[model samples]
Target: MKSAILAVVLAMPPQAILAEDVPTTVAHPRPVISEIVTADPARARRFPGVIEGENVATLGFLTGGRLASVPVEAGDQVMQGDTLATLDQVTLQQDLASARAALETVQAKATLAAQQFARAETLRARGVASDAMLDNARANRDAIAAKVKNARASLTRAEDAAQYSTLTAPTEGIVLSVLAEPGATVSAGSAVIKLAAPTGREAVIDVPEAFAALLPPDAVFSLRRDKNDTAATTARLSVIEPVAETSLGTRRLRLALDNPPKDYRIGSLVEASYATVSAPLMTLPRVAIAIAEGPNGPGVWRIEGADRRAHFIAVTLGNTIGDRVVIRDGIAVGDEIVTRGAHALTENQNVGDRLE
Candidate 1:
């Protein structure tokens, strides 16, 4: 009976062997993707930029002195001739007092000299004084007269110096900065305050010299706050710097804002958009194109054949407008182009199974 049981077990297949021989279905999940068709359209070019005032002036004292008091602070609105600060006028006052005293002394001396000259002229008329004595008296009077004039000039100059102790605003604008504080000693012409006229704000942007030829004279531009999604302020191109800013590898372009915001301050960052060119061209989302090695060189992916399989298509790229790029050639309107999931696609790949 044992021998018969052994023979039956050999005739039947082992359980492990049967399990390994079983067949099963392997399922692959298709990737989800979104796509758009190539269409000919015009798009604008958005460039990063910054806001700036048309007129920015640094306020400072004409004479060097200790800053006695600063009445205005940063962000203070000021008008032309408004007192911004005052310097210690102790020395200036003393100089003016001395000048006045000197003028008085010179005037008194001039009066005495005039009386002596008259006396000398009378003596000469009576033949008691010689011509030389009369001439001496007249010369002394003239010398004293010149001294009085010099003293008066000195007084005027001293008074003018005293007036310089007060720092005044140059234009109607807001104070952007206050460099000197009370008791701070500043040198002559040292910047003590920064003024900016927001009413004359301009949008300044830097563009590469290579692309400068594409820009037009008096082109319209749009400017908005950096990282902002709000509507931009319209401006017109007014200046193109003759020399390129080598440090930035770009040329400066200035635009005059039509109506600036009341709260728009100077030195605020902004983004600028310039319409370089407008032409009928096929544009597609940046993601729709996939770079791959082809028989010639770099190529993009496109749906080909009724099966809509991904195929490598060679194309020449043009300028990029926002998130879309212009395909110079190789793509046409109504052409179904993959926008997403194109990075993983290869030639002959079945896009029908691709997920959107």
Candidate 2:
């Protein structure tokens, strides 16, 4: 019975291997690690701009004359209908006076002709004056009446000329420049002053034609004094120049500011940026992107928190801005990504933390 038992035991499968007796190998590698930086998908990029008035007006005289007075200068604010400048009224006044005298003379002649016609009519009725005499008196009266009407029209024109000698502001605005000095002779309709409306302040920026074409139709914007300034004001894309500037290869964009800061003034330099974010995205260092694809798609070598091993995680990529790329998916915030030497890493490989 003992021999039979021994034979059964010897034929039995070798005793089960002990786990403690087995040896395992572990790998440790030092790799660059970058903490995920959470931010708005649409990052603001600044472009230079200038603050200016939306409506810029060039004011001048309706008629030619020497400028006797110019009451406003650059930076002076004026209301609508305020006198801006005036021409020497001496010539206009003299012309008006002469017209008035001419009118008076024509009126006297008409009065005398009317009296003579009345006398002629009575004499003809009494059979003393001939029909020829009545006819001549009537002709003289009609001729004088026509002269009086012409004289009255001349007087009215003279009065208008005198009134036009003074130039007034068409609207409330600030004077931007004084093109003509006092006592300077200017031609009719020549620009004398440059005025800008108080309202309608806008930020003027030059955008490359290519860049402008890429912008969305409803893209929003904001303005700031500088890149470091935290304060921002809303802005609307008001107008875009139909034609591009050949020399600069850029198009003019006018952005109307909303509730702008008090320091914003005409000619002030500003920075403008897009306010709308198309999508929420995660940003990662450009070096972290691997050329190879994973089972899902484009991926990164993500380090495991507990194991300190690199694992390939598929990700959807987006636009790259500078040295960073927009991550559309797969990686969560706070995930440690291999920024450098990611191309050399393999799936589930041990990694060392190196933060820079």
Candidate 3:
């Protein structure tokens, strides 16, 4: 019975069977599409940074001696004239006392010599003392007087040295580090502490020379605690180191923050974001591009009309930025291109959204 039914259907008109075998092709909706336009014209670059001071000063003692006491430590706040450290005062006091004692002895000898010279002068006037003896008395008195003058000058310097034995802060600031401790001997002019002025806070960043070359003198900056945080604030470019660091191939950039957060102190970690200036160019989604086996423009399958038919259009590509590539030519704004399944498309093929 089945063979008989099949034979009856095949005996029908040949035109009816041919028409039922071939189905008509229909234009379908596009799933993924991209419009040609200027995309992300400004390129933003980020660098890690830290808060720093413009005027950081390293302090040391003027007179070398064994440190007897250190009143301030790291992270301590200090004011002008505040004592930072003190050298052993016993040796200083003894030196001062010796200078004073020496001065007293010279003064006593000078007094005795003057009195002897006076007696000799009186005797010489009465013709009782020899001329040679009188001359010797005068020379001793003058020499002792010169000795007294020398002793007085030595005493003055001893007093000054005693004063310099105590190290004091020159200005109000926060101490960053203390290199010397009590009982340690340090030489004069050797750094004992590091201090930074609390006036201007700035961000220091090491940027690659390639990126630094494109940055303008007046480039703008924004600093944030982290990359994902939106609580960022603005900063201004203050200086760029002229010489590149040969070892790192980078240059240091100093940016001033007019209104930084209260918690943003010296050495605070931050991220600096800034934009690079470049000429505007046309671009398309990276997914819309596909490699073809030809020499000329690796054509893109462009979608057109309400029918959503795919057409292969050749184009010239430039640089690639993030998820998009620059379209130098052969495409204009408002043109839709197939972003998904471009590899499976052909010229004038009916393409549409695939139902999941």
Candidate 4:
């Protein structure tokens, strides 16, 4: 009876619960981890931009007139004082001629008055004329002199008006647009031509308000068409507008391109980068971060023991630098951090095939 009781007890499933937990000795693949170290950080900011000339102007007529001849067309290169257009000058010419004739007549009268005054003075000196008579001659001479001055001034004004009938380039530049054609009437101060100075080009970019504050006054820039090629040229920060544009909520920044490309055209779209801030930072592969259940909440992968098993460590992450993130407090330098296969790991999970 005693032997049978011992056998029954032995057969009753060993009296201990065998928990089927994941084997700690199972050689699962370990994740590759890179040590976090302090290094120079790259400071970068991107902004949209367009190429533009330094000087741009809209040329206009100074006087109202019917356009008779437009000597230059759009895209025409002009020099200072080059004729751009001509107005109907027949009326102006007639007025100038009438003014000159009137001026000539006034000058003849003034000359006769001067001669009469001289004769009256000579007669008074010889006691042949009364003082009152001499005074009358002097007054007549002064009146004619005033008439002559007025006529000459009128002639000068008429000449200037005639000159205004012709349009000339104010400065050397490329003609970008022609508003009025031949036979079209243009009013004074109406834009007739668009001129762009060819000295150098400037790029205007709108920087986001967040990045604008971090940008340095003298930050360097590289301008390029694509990422594969080297930058065609470099630019320096020239202007930082004080006011932010209401529509874009961004600040305006101007960069002066040194030796701008020949293919650069006004209004051409461009990509620009502004180095805002830089500092030493720790970096790791993006795969090192993992979200797993922990005592508090979700956590990341961290090695704890000599076996390099993964530990679900809670981390407070900071700014991301490229593929890596800044760890605020969770992990430290010399800590073995799993970089890959982190998602498949669990707390206290044994791992094998450890990688450097």
Candidate 5:
């Protein structure tokens, strides 16, 4: 029976055998979007900024009164302790006198109460005064002493107000604006003069939330007065506003100038740009990167030269600059990388010829 079956199979035509064979899946070299890896400095993002004082101040009195005189004007340079403005002294003096008289009255009353309290204690020791009488005398003395203390505090405050009536430069600075005029009645804490301190000047720039979010810690900025790039100088990020400006959705960045020019004065219009600190790093578009399918994860599809195959290589990502991201590792300069359809690619997939 076995010989008979073998003879019948051999007699079958070659076309019949070939037709019944299992088919094979064909994988063609896939066309890919790619970019040649190159190391270059990051594109700088420019912003408009202004030079401002380190700690600007608005001068005002602690107590409200009619302004007698304003000795300084906008753009005037004043030294520490220089008089900026003064309030009418008559009201302050009258208040001081009232405080003094009140204190004197309370002190006199306290003295009389002390004498009564002492006499009451003596009488009580002699068995001539009742315990209730001694207690009452002590209470009266305590109450009068408290009033004296309160009056003295009032007197001290009055004296302080006398000095507060005169507004003086707390520090050497240039007056930026005059808020109040002479003879104008102003309330306590009302702005009288705007003063910009001589030191702690910085560049004030509004950075969008997206850029500020990716701002590197060591990032430096180049500043130029107006549009003159010829006179550019460097600065370091010093401070950022905790809150974003509501209207523009941006944060205020304060960049401390490095050896700023003398012409970089207060309110100077300037332009700022971010500068990279380290050596030029490799960059790739967002589409070139993929998550997972890599041994270390968050990798890209790298195309090898000899085989022309795409392989998954995990990379360390640096700061995201604009649309491209910096690749810290896992690939070197001159390596071709897939920029599109990376996430859908499998390991060792044959990629078509490099589109140089």
Candidate 6:
């Protein structure tokens, strides 16, 4: 009987099939990349930096004098002991002459006193001079000798001042900046030029106060000349400035770069990247963060329970590290946060299992 009915239905035909005859397809939940909320992944935090010499020396004069000539300009590479600047040579020479004359006069007086003391000693031995007279002559000779010694010391100091009129490079390096010029009255120990040594180069970056505490010591930093540069250099954390910048609240950090390429010269602007092992705050991909409406700022879709329902969670945002941003408050560790395909998700929507 079933065969006869099937044959009759097949004969009934081409236009006889009804639209309701088709089976209804069941809709499954949407699949998403529900990544676990944790500390920032090993993505390095990149900071714009400038290359600087580690052994930076502030060159200045030893004697306060009118700057006669500043021969070397900024960016000039100089050798150790090379003349960088000079004070007034005429004034230095005059000072030396004055000191020499003073010394000569003192020496003449000392010689005359010695002769008088010897004559007094001879008279005292012959009973012609009294004991008090011999004592007076000896005291005069001693006082004159002391004056001569003081005058000689002053002459030596004057000679030194003459030599100090010339300011020379203390080490082999490039002149970073020239602060003083000719005819400028500069005091002793006043900086005239800034010099950076040829070696011990480093990278300097001003990190935001938000990430200052999270920075690890001796952390390796990837350095590059430009943002689109493919070739890069590396540096390690050397030191950090204790004081924060008053306006921006950023602390300066220095990283040691060993044997960097020739392009990594001092004052060259470069980008520095450092991957932190443990970030102070948890971070999520910017793609996962959604701008909330009204009082709520930014937020992320977090999945909960075995049912795999996504809930819109409001999060306070901090600094942005690359494509990721810091979550100052919002989610906790081990929370399932949707990293991919998060835009279309609704409140309490059932998202499918984590996508590979």
Error of 3 at 45 (Å): 4.5
Better of 3 and 4 by lDDT: 3
Give lDDT tens digits, candidate 2, residues 1-356: 99999998778655444455676686557556556546543345568999998899998888777788998888899999999999889877888899999999999999999999999999999999999999999999999999999999989878877888989999899888899998888877999989999877899988776556545566568888877888888888877889999998888888888788778988789988878564544778778888665357577888886758888888888777567777878887678788777888877787766545
Measured by lDDT, the strongest candidate is 5
TM-score to true structure, per model: 0.53, 0.51, 0.54, 0.49, 0.70, 0.60
Clashing pairs in 6: none
Question: Which pairs of residues clash in candidate 4, taking residues 3 or more apart in a chain or in different chains?
Answer: none
Better of 1 and 4 by TM-score: 1
Consecutive 10-residue window with the lowest summed lDDT within model 5: 37-46
lDDT of each: 0.76, 0.82, 0.81, 0.74, 0.86, 0.84
Q: Of the candidates numbered 1 and 3, which has the greater lDDT value?
A: 3
Model 4: residue 333 alpha-carbon error in angstroms: 16
Tens digit per residue, CA lDDT, model 4, 78-114: 9999998887888678878999999999999999999
Q: How far in Å is the alpha carbon of 187 misplaced in model 5?
A: 8.7
lDDT of 5 at 193: 93
How do the residues 170-228 of candidate 6 rate in per-residue lDDT, one tens digit apiece?
A: 88999999999899989889999899898878899988775676555667778889878
Model 3 lDDT per residue over 44-89, tens place:
6678999987788998888677788988887788999998888888
State in Å the error of residue 116, model 6: 3.4
Whole-model lDDT, candidate 2?
0.82
lDDT score of residue 316 within candidate 1: 74
Model 5 TM-score (2 dp): 0.70
Where does candidate 4 stray beyond 4 Å?
A: 1-48, 55-82, 115-133, 157-172, 177-194, 206-214, 222-234, 241-251, 275-356
Residue range 1-356, candidate 5, lDDT tens digits: 99999999999999877777967678889888898897653336689989988889987998787899998888788999999999989988998999999999999999999999999999999999999999999999999999999999999988987878889999899998999988899988999999998877899999886667666655689998766468789999887788998899898999988889998888889999887656556789987889983367798888986879988888999877678887988898888889987877888899877666
